[model samples]
Target chain A: MSTSPVTARLDRGVPRFGGFKLAIVRLEIRRQLRNRRTVFFTVAFPVFFFLIFGLNNAYASDPIGRGNESAFIMISMALYGTVLATSNGGATVSVERLSGWSRQLRITPLQPSAYIAIKMATSLVLGLVAILSVYIVAAFTHKPSMPLGLWFATGAAIWIGSLLFTAFGLFIGYLLPSENVMQLIGFALMLFSFGGGLFIPLSQFSHPLRVLATYTPLYGLNQLVHYPLVQGSFNWSWLSNLVSWLIIFTVGATWRFKRDTARV
Target chain B: MAERDVVPRTPPALELKGVRKDFGDVHAVRGIDLRIEPGEIVAFLGPNGAGKTTTIDMMLGLSVPSAGTVSVYGRTPLDAVRLGLVSAVMQSGGLLKDLTVAETVEYTAHLFTGARPVDEVMERAGISLIADRLVAKCSGGEQQRLRFAMALLPDPDLLLLDEPTQGMDVEGRRAFWKAIRHDAQAGRTIVFATHYLDEADAYADRVVLIREGEIVADGSAAEVKALASGRAVRATLFGADQATLRALPGVDHVEVHANSILLHCADSDAVARYLLTQTNAKDIEITARALEDAFVALTGSHARDESVQSNADEVLR
Candidate 1:
């Protein structure tokens, strides 16, 4: 056997960051965008909810916080959109796991950290798209009355806060089988959104339910994102909730990923 | 100067020392010890459930062994793989169904440090024409070729193909092997697992026959074929005593069916000559035992053991 021109120049060093990792993120984004179901649920659903819930005059007539009720609903809907986008993006890992793509990746030069980074990066990108789309719709139609800085701050907060759900999605994607992943994620998302005051204000919940709502994973993210528009100050509970859930989900995701990839 | 002098030789391409794998109660691979030298094209010849895929998975570091070690080029399997020293075309379920052929190739190419140019690899795999086709729309053979192209991306020194041509048509299989042969000629150490004896015989420099998770035979095609108790000579002879024919030189066993005598012989040529000159034998036929028969003969012992265990249970009951 003789060496070929291609084999002669084989590079043996470990690759630097940003080459293959960025390619993986780009490919993941392209593939996710191609899935109409993902787009509809992540981007379109929250916008649709905003149109239905935000158009009413009752919330606008009654001032709830720093802004009016329309502003509150808009921020909640955007947060919901980001949550959906990031969670769905993370959940796609279940399909990839089932398809043995993770196994294929294990045999490659690409580091496991790089693969996780790619997934997180992709989820963040999709979350950005979801947040911006909802915010754009609200800016045009609902015209929620708020200072321009607060609006951008709220959007940034929601986008950043969705990282917890992204980790949550990763935890479940690696923990659950592919067949049960979407159903579980959908049910969990509905419950979290309701409890977190994304769909309904926590003030409207019964005393016991409102207590439980504070403990839900999304509660902290919801409060954090709405703080700028509603409170204009940080709530210690909101910061603690977000930090605690982030740590839990990140640890769970890392453990599950290691266990899943280590299996024969 | 010789080519070997021009380049320093590396360690063995692959080495498995007392490798074992267990899936709960079922021991998929009992213990396998193998050393494959660099530039050797070895075929892991085995039937389904004979641990070929498991062995390949362990070698590729897709699965960790229950015990012992597997190394490629003296590095741990995973380390070797990460260094782009080894690559594999797995049997199935490794590909993304959504990506187009070209996208898949390009995407995988980007994951490696020194992948071959995408278009060159596509052309080499004979998938250039179908580059625009979605992976889900490609045929089984096309998907295999796509996997082949991915394996070639890193220009890996050692290529592991797990039942690479499992579902290909005859022509597709021929072309697949042609491309593999091209790789082999370019100094790649190729290890492919296959149930097809002819594939091992034709394409591999050495054939390692595995049965019930252990290597039953390891040698060249002819050498492995010789592991089965030799060839059979059939001849028409009237009123010939089976006992007398069984006692002939080179003959191991004899079966008489009507007027024809079947002699299982270590040396079929000697038996044939004896049958032609001394005996009133006619219409003689000598057939070497096919690898299929050898495989059955090798694995049949397990079936026999199970039956014996069942018989003992019945007696106890």
Candidate 2:
């Protein structure tokens, strides 16, 4: 057999993380965008919550901290959306793992780090969509009356701070069995939302329960995103809490990923 | 024969050196050493739980060996795959259910550097007709064909298929092997694992029979068949001396019943002739063993040898 045509088509160069990684990212984004259930949870659910809570008359004029109740409710809903979008994005790994696609990828040239990076990037994009969707709803219905700087800062803080949940989602995706994954995630999301003061402010709770709420993973993010709008300053405790949980979740995710991809 | 004679001087397409894999207390593969030259079509024939998938996983770099190493074209398996030197069609569940057949092929093609044209690959894999069907809706045979298309994307020089036709009907199996033969003619090395004796006999240039995590036989189909080639002679003889019957020419083993003697021999015709003329024997019958019997006999002996070896090791310890 002549070798010229076959040899010419062989790509001998080492694979780099450029176009190939982007291709995977694009593929994942397109596939996830088609899932209507995921779209509802990550994009629409939070917008609905924002609509219901932002239009309430109970907290509309009442002063909580720095911003009135409407602004506070809007920020809380936006944070809820951001966390859900990012975590749900990362949680898609469970489906891939269950289908044995991860093993298929192990045989390919794509590096594990590149795969994780693509998932995280996709999560960030979804988080951006969620935040914007909530903000758009707020703009049309009842826009929060806060300074422009504080508004941008709050949005930026919510987007960046919600990244910890992406790692958390990956950790759960690898840690739990696939069958119970979504149910557990939904239950945990509700618990975290309540405990982190997203639905109800921690101030109403007793001293001990309020203190416990501060230690939850979502608590730091909630406080950080609300700081500029609610307090107009950064809290060192909240920053430390965010940084520590970030490290913990990132470590947990990497460890679980390595173990999951190892030979069964 | 024509392909084997042109032995290229370059490194083999795949080489496994003393590879062993242990999962907790279960030893999946134990010390497998194999080499397949480029353009050679080799079949791994084994029964269930015979370590075929584990070995294939190591070869594809999806699983690391507990001992020894695997080299693909003088480089690591992962590197060889990265360079488009090798690709594989796994046993099951690699395709995403959400994507259509054509979309799956397109997405895989985008991952590689210079993938072949998606339309041509779909045609070659016989999935062009079902290009728009979602993977979840495709039948098992169609999904296998879609996997074949993905493996063809890189135009790889070496292809590994793990039970590529497991769920395929007879016609689909025939078409799949025909396509494989076409690729082999273009000088691509193919290694496939299957439990089907007919598939190995019909498709492989060399059949490697594995049993209990070890290679019991490796040769051309005919050559391996020769290992268990013999005939059985059963005859009813009155007043036959057991020693004299055992001493009969060409007889390898003898088992006596109440009214008959069964003989396993290299030349059943000779034994039959002796029994008819020299002894008061009646109702004599001779029959040759089938390839299935040969496969069983070959694998059965290996199982016995392994047990004996383990017993000896126990004694030594």
Tens digits of per-residue lDDT, candidate 1, B1-317, equal 37645564456788899999999999999999999987899999888888999999899887889999998877778777777889999988777888889999988888877778999989988899999998999998899999999999988889999999987887789888888887688888999998777788899999999888999889998888666658878889998887778888877778898998888779888888888898899999988666447576544654675689899999999
- lDDT for each residue of candidate 2 in A1-264, tens digit (9 for 90 to 100): 322222323446546683256666677787878878778887798889877887787667577566677888888988887888788877878888888877776666666777788888988888888888888788777556777677788899888887899998899888875856866887898899988999987999899999998888888889888887777567788878788889998999999998886664
Q: Which lDDT value does model 2 have at B244?
A: 85
> What's candidate 1's DockQ score?
0.37
Clashing residue pairs in all predictions, respectively, total 0, 0
Candidate 1: segments with Cα more than 4 A from true spot: A1-11, A18-20, A61-64, A232-234, B1-8, B229-264, B267-317
Best by lDDT: 1
Worst 10 residues of 1 chain B by lDDT: B1-10
lDDT of 1 by residue, A43-117 (tens): 899999988888787666467566777788888988887888888878878988898877777778877777778
TM-score of each: 0.83, 0.83
Candidate 1 is scored at a TM of 0.83
Model 1 misses residue A119 by how many Å? Answer: 0.5
User: Model 2, B154: alpha-carbon shift in Å?
Assistant: 1.8
RMSD values, in order shown = 9.4, 9.6
